[model samples]
Structures are given as C-alpha cells and as structure tokens.
Target: MTNLTCFKAYDIRGKLGTELNEEIAYKIGRAYGQIYCPQKVVIGCDIRLTSEDLKQATIRGLNDAGVNVLDLGMTGTEEVYFGAFHLDVQGGIEVTASHNPMDYNGMKLVRENARPIGADSGLKDIQALAESGHFQEMSQKGTTEQYNILPEFVDHLMTYIDPAKLRPLKLVMNAGNGAAGHVIDALEDKFKQLSIPIEFIKIHHEPNGHFPNGIPNPILIENRGYTSDAVLAHQADMGIAWDGDFDRCFLFDEKGQFIEGYYIVGLLAQAFLLKQKGEKIVHDPRLVWNTLDILKEYDGIAVQSQSGHSFIKDMMREHNAVYGGEMSAHHYFRDFAYCDSGMIPWLLATVVLSETKQSLSSLVEDMIKKFPCSGEINFKVKDTQKTIQKIFDHFADQKPMLDQTDGVSLDFGAWRLNVRASNTEPLLRLNIESRADQNPKPMQDYVDELTQLIQS
Candidate 1:
C-alpha cells in the first residue's frame, strides 16, 4: 500500500517513486471519477517528464470508471480549468508538481466550472477512496480523445485586452525551461500583428524535464539573478517569468529590480476595479493590507480569504468578485471561471502599463514604500506544531490581535507577522510586513528574536 502522507492540505504532491507513481495516480483518477461521476472530464499537464505518464495512467483510471476524457495535450493547469468550463465538462485535472523540484510531482483537481477540490472539500473523500484500495467497477468502459486547445485559448485570451492600445514596449521573458515558453510563443505571434513594438528577449524558453539546475520558481533569491540579468542585458521595459506549469508569474522592472507579488496584486486589483467599479475583489489574508487599501480606494469591495488557490477561487465565486489575488503570485479572474492563471496576469499588466504610459516600476514604487516586507522566510525545523505554539504563546498576550486563518498571524500597532507551516515541506514559513518606522531597528529586532526562539 502506498503511504498517502503526500495527500496534502491543498493538493497531492510528493517525491516521484517512493510516494507517488502510476498506480497511485490511476487510483486517484478512479476515485475522482467515482466521486464526481461526470459524463465528460478534461485533463492536462505541464512540461515535467512524469506528466505524460501520470496523465495516461490517470486517464486509464477514468476510462475504467466509464468517464469520457478530453485530453488536452501539454498545457498549463489553467488551460485544464478553461477546458473544463469552456467545454462544459463535469471536472478537470492537471498533472503537475508546479514549482517543486524535478523529482516531485502532484495533481491539481477541480470540479465542474473549475471549482477546486482541496482537503476540506472533496480531497479528503478522494484520499479515503484511494487508501481503501477498493472501488465499485463500471460495466461499460469510457473512451478517451485528445484535442489541441492552444489556438482557441489564445484567441479567447486576446479578446480580454486590446493590444492596439498598448505601446511598443520591449520586454524580457524567462520561461526557465518550463511550460510557459510555448504559451509565450503563441502570444508573441499575435502581438506582431497588432503593430505593438514589443520585442521579447527569451531565455531558457524550452521545456526540459530534467530542469538541469532547479525548478523555475522565481520566488527564490537565487532564481531572480537569471531573470534580472536578462532584463539588464536586453534593456527591456520589464521582465516576466513563470513557474514550471506557468500557473503564476514574477516580474522585474526595467531597472532589473524584482517586484513583489503583493504589489502586482494591488496593481491588478486597481486595474480591474477601474473598469468594473464596485465589484468585489477576493484576496488572501497574508500580506493583504496593500490590496485592501487599494481596493478600498478604488471603491471595490475587498474580501479576505485563507491563503490557497482553492479557497481564493471559491470565495471569489461566492462574492462574484471581478478579480482575486494572492501574495504567492496566483491571480484569479471571474471571467476565467474564477481559476488562477499564470499567463493572464502578465498580459493584463502589460496592457495596464501600456495604456497608462507608466513604467511598471513607477506604478508600484509607492506601494513598496508604504508596506515594507521581509519576503517570506523559511526555517527548517523538526517540530512545526511546537514552533507555532511557542510563537503563539509568546505573542498572544502582547499583540493587539491574533488570527489563525492561514496559520498564526499577530498584529500590533503598525506591524504584523504570520508564521505558517508549509503543506508540502517540513518547514515554517514566516512573513512580516510593517508600516514606516523611525528606524528599521524594531523590525530587525523582532526578526532576530523570532530567529533565536526558533533556533534555540
């Protein structure tokens, strides 16, 4: 029996051989079919080498359970979501490990209309079914068919924003050898026809399963160097990069400075609110002050949600939000069935900058100064529960307020910190944000104190 330790809070992610394999993927697919019992299902994958094999096995399970499959060959997770909603299918699945290492693989599941299935939702049922290792058999076998949704998807995406309004802006795009390169290629061709003076400086655009060095996660300080260098070398207006499956995007300004996802969230929120005034915007609890402030200023309703794609999407749908964003770079749109997209954010951002005649740097400069944050810090620890309890106990009495929406968030007068354990890794992730202080000493002291407490 395969140990389902990897059945996480959000999705199923684990090292390839020991925890996840073809058999387990098949069982998951079978269980998913039994639970959802959809007439038609759509499936897709990233560029990871294991993706195709896992997709095939998963399809086998679905077919065995008499569920017809629409296999979207080699597309991003969002594409699967789009296929599900566009085709009016009952459910969808994307076989991807996202930004994890090459040795890792996972699945992102969604119900009809792109509703996410996380641990609190249908994930636990799927997990139990997989563990039981016994499922009802279907008398009739299902059929499988493959289709290319790229051309239609690209066409549909282009309709959202007008390229004619965009000024000719030179930009650098680093795919980091992930699945984003192909999508970029399709968009570049369309941009050419619009007479947009957009020159794309590409690097590591090819999809390589080995990932040779590391996964294409731009959140890491080390990964930013490559993209920064590309921006400087090309002297572009801005730089954009995506993770393995192109589900989220990272940006660098013309000066090669990496922009935080929080600022991007604000920018996107403001853009959406300007067009659709009074529309609700859903944002994660982590680092939401900037987003909330912007939304309120724009007369947009701000809805705070737990930090996760599943939660954000569900909340967005319930609120009928025009947009949803997370500090982790996931951006969701009501038009896209409330599904997060790695491709749309950059496209929309470019349109925003181009139409306004403002550089990306200038747009986010004020927000950065207003909310100085120490980008997420991860600490490897043996006992996540103990560390969380220690932090909670230490600050519970002294802090003005404490919340456990995502993890442990303590708010003081002008400063807030959230410490949450990663669902996929054995580490505690800490995020701190604060308003202007007389000096940086207080924040530094707080970080030092927390570090010492955890280390000691």
Candidate 2:
C-alpha cells in the first residue's frame, strides 16, 4: 500500500520519488475515476519536469478504471476547468505542483462544472481508495485523446476584456518561465489586432520543465527584482507576473512597487461592483477592512470566508458570488464555474483600468494608504497547535471582541493581527493591518513581540 501521508487536506502533493511517483499517481487516477465515474474526464498539467511522466501514469490509471480522457496538453490549471465546463466533461484533474518547488508535484481535482473535490467533499474517499489499492475491474478500458485548448482558452479570455477599450500603455509581463508565456504570446496577437499601443516586455517566458532556478513564485522577495527591473526599464504602466502553473499572479506599479494581493482583491471587487451594482463579492477574512468598506460603499454584499482555494470557491458557489479573491492572489469568477485563475485577474484588471481611465497606481493609491499591512510572515515552529494556542491564550482577554472566523484575529482600535496555522506547512502565518492614522511602528512592535514568543 502507498503511504497516505501524501494525501493532503486539500489535494495530493509530496516530494517526487520518496512520497510520490508514477505508481502512486496511477492509483490516484484510478480511484478518482472510480469515485466520480464521469462519462469523460479532462486532464491538464503544468511545465514541471516530472509532469509529463506523471500525466501519462495518471491517464493510464484513469483509462484502466474505464474513464475516457480528454487530454488538454501543456496548459494552465484554468484551462482544464474551462475544458471541463466547455466540453461538458464529467470531471477534470490538473497535474500541477503550482508554485511549489521543482522536486514536488500534486493534483487538483474537480467534479462537473469544475466543482472542487476538497477534504470534506470527496478527496478523503479518493485517498482511502488509493491507499486500499483495490478497485473493481472494468469490462472495457477507457481511451485517451489529445486536444490543444490554448487557442480556445485565449478566445474565451478575450471576451471578458475588449482590447480596443484599453488606453495606450506599456506593460511588462514576466511569465517566470511557466506555461503562461504561450498564452500571453497569443494574447499579444489579439492586442495587436485592436491597435492598442501596448508594449509587452517579457522575461523567462519559456516553458522549461527544469524550472532552471526555482518554481517562479513572485511572492518571495528574491523574485521581485526581475519584475521590478522590467517595469523600470520599460517605464511601463504596470507589470504583471505569474507563478509556475499560472494559477496565481502578482503585480507591480509603474514605480516598481510590489502591490499586495489584498489590495488587488479590493481593486477588482470594486471594479466588478461598478458593473453589477449590489452584487455579492466573496473575500477571505485575513484582510477585510478595505474590501468590506469598498463593498459597503458600493452597496454590495461582502461575504467573508476562510483563506484557501477550496474554501473560497465553495463559498462563492454557495452565495452565487460574482467574484471571489484570496490574499494569495488566487482569483475566482462566476463565469468560470467559480474556479480560480491566474490569467483572468490581470485581464480583468486591465479592463477595469481602461474603463475607469485611471492608472493602476492611482486606483490602488488610497487602498495602500488606508491599509498598511505587514504582509504575511511565516514562522517555522516545532508545535503548530501549541504555538497557535499560546498566541490565542496571550490575547484571550480580548477574545470576546475579536474575529475568530478562520484564525485568532484580535482588533485594537488602531491596528489588528491575524495569526493562523498554514494548511500546507508546519508554520504559523501572521498578518498585521493598521489604520491610516496609526504608524506601522506599533504593528511591527507587535510582530516582533509575537515572533519572539513563538520562537521561544
């Protein structure tokens, strides 16, 4: 029996040979096929070195379980979701590690209409089946066929934003050597047809499986320089960069300042609200002041949820939310079956700027000043539960008035902090937000105090 440790809370992920391999992937595929038993299944993968091999193994497993496969070769996570909905497939699975290190990989599964299969849903059953290593034999094996969906995906994306509406602006786009470059190249051709005077400066735009340096995660301070340099060199209106699988994107202003994902969430939420007045928008509770305030001003309903793709997507479907976003830059859309996409957010942001006649910087200027955040700080600790309890106990006196939605969020008059355990790591994630009048000093001081406590 395969080790069940790789069966994560949300999806399957682990190191390459030791924890995950072709055999394990094949078993997972068979288990997913047996459990869902859809008429057809859509499969896609990122550009990690081991992805193709894993994909083959997964397809074999699915085929063995009598599930026909529609292979969307070498595409983003969203493409698989699109294929699932567009082709009316029974379900879909994207074999991607996302922004994880090269040595690691995982799978993101979905039912019909791209509905996610999370822990509470069907992932646990699939894990149990895979671990049991038993399955009913099929009368006839399923078949596999390859289909290229890039052109179709690009065309669908363009429907959301009119290129002619955009102003003449220079933009820098860094694909971080992921699968986004091909899609971005196709988008550039579409922009040319509209006569929109835009320059696209690109870096690491190739789909290299080696990932040369590391998975192109822009959140790390080290990766910021590449995007920042491109923005400055081109004197562009803004810079947009994506992670390894293009499931999440990061942004930079013309001045080369890294914009927080929370701010983008508010920006995009405001944009959507303007179009559909009083529409419901879902957002994570980690950073809510600016977003909630903006939604209220627009007379729209603000729905708060826990941070994570599965949680946010589920809430979006439940509320029939027009849009949803998390602090991690994962953006969800109603039109896309409530699935998160790294490409659509930037496209929608561009359209928002075009309609508002405001620069990206100008749109988010006030939001930055309104909510001065310390970003997310991670602490590697021995005991995650004990650490969380320690922090919760320290602030227990103020617990009655605090927000305990997803974690322990304590509010003072001027500042607030949210400390929660990471679902994917052995670390406590801390986020600090301060009011406009308060100096960031107090926030920093609290962070220092908390860090010391956690470390000790």
Per-model CA lDDT versus the true structure = 0.87, 0.86
- lDDT (tens digit, per residue) of candidate 2 on 1-456: 655767766777878997789998999999999998887899999899899899999999999999999998898888998988888688999998887777888888889988888888899999999999889999999999998888888888888887668777788999988889989999899788877677788888888988775679888778889899989988988899899889899989889989999999998898888888989899987877888879988878989888878888899999999999888789999998898888889888778777887888889999888878888888888887788789878877765358878878878767778888877556788888878876546567877888888898
Residue 296, model 1: Cα distance from true site in angstroms: 2.3
Q: Residue-pair clashes per candidate, as listed? A: 1, 0
RMSD of 2: 1.5
- State the local distance difference test value for candidate 2: 0.86
Looking at candidate 1, the ten consecutive residues that score lowest on lDDT are: 436-445
Inter-residue clash pairs, candidate 1: 168-197
Superposition TM-score, candidate 2 onto the true structure = 0.97
Q: What are the runs in model 2 whose C-alpha is more than 4 Å off?
A: 438-442
Q: Who wins the lDDT comparison?
A: 1
